[model samples]
Target: MSADRVVQLRWEPRHVADDGRVELSYPGISVVSSRQGEVVDRKWVPVGEEPTFADDEALIAVLHAAWRWTRPAA
Candidate 1:
């Protein structure tokens, strides 16, 4: 039998502001949540399908996600 694999997912958030933007993000995703826990902006990548990648490719995707979340609303 093949070994069932599972990847952990996590979300990080920054403090809330009157501007209604909470810096929410995951390992390979970007998201913006409101003070009311409403998701206004978000990003998700389909990594589950692959479950494997070259070292650089995996790192780059993670970096891009983080950049998107912290990016200055461009």
Candidate 2:
């Protein structure tokens, strides 16, 4: 198992702008998604280390993840 603890939050696309892609992905060690009007989307398992900016090595990885996840223009 990976050293990083998976952090999952219920999916809320609105809430996902920041670290939301983590929630939108297919297998987040943790998953957070839309739960409105009594509807449930398929769940995902999220897994990743809590990124630390102070550490140069992990910082790059975190940044890349963030960059890849930006939402498209509506």
Candidate 3:
């Protein structure tokens, strides 16, 4: 069996508007996976909007899906 992973995410504003709508920088989503309190894996993705995940697994799944969808046709 594998240890459970926990995800941590951070968002930084790319641009701040007068109306208070901030544009998150491309690849704004930073996903960090930790196991036993030690980070194991990390990835970045341009979600294009604020993303919320219930847990690390959810975040990872969404990132992978987004990446696949955005990849150029081969």
Candidate 4:
């Protein structure tokens, strides 16, 4: 089996401009949409050494598996 790897994620709240535009995207990321109490949609944000994935669902699945695998015995 391949060696285990650690992942990290960093999130920073975006700043809104006086013209009602909020900057939700980072330098290499894209912000699809943002609304009050609805959702802050984004394309994808890079979290680690790997290149950013076009689809975040895959990343979410990997994280879910890691969480379950590393949990303490019940």
- Candidate 1 least-lDDT 10 residues: 1-10
Give the runs in model 3 whose Cα sits over 4 Å from its true position.
Answer: 1-4, 12-27, 49-60, 63-74
Cα error, residue 8 of model 4, in Å, equals 6.9
- Give the whole-model CA lDDT for all candidates, comma-separated: 0.42, 0.35, 0.56, 0.42
Candidate 2 lDDT over 1-74, as tens digits, reads 12122223443222244464554323232232222233223333333455344444443454444333332233
The lDDT, on a scale of 0 to 1, for candidate 1 is 0.42
Locate the minimum summed-lDDT window of 10 residues in model 4: 1-10
Sorted on TM-score, highest at the top, how do the candidates line up?
A: 3, 4, 1, 2
Give the range of the ten consecutive residues with the poorest summed lDDT in model 3: 65-74
Per-prediction RMSD in angstroms?
A: 16.1, 16.1, 10.7, 12.6
Candidate 3 similarity to native, TM-score: 0.39
True-vs-predicted CA distance for residue 28, candidate 1, Å: 16
Better of 3 and 4 by TM-score: 3
Q: Alpha-carbon error at 71 in model 1, in Å?
A: 2.0
lDDT comparing candidate 4 with the true structure: 0.42
> Highest lDDT among the candidates is held by which one?
3
lDDT, model 2, position 44: 35
How many clashes (backbone atoms < 3 Å, residues ≥3 apart in a chain or on different chains) does model 3 have? 0
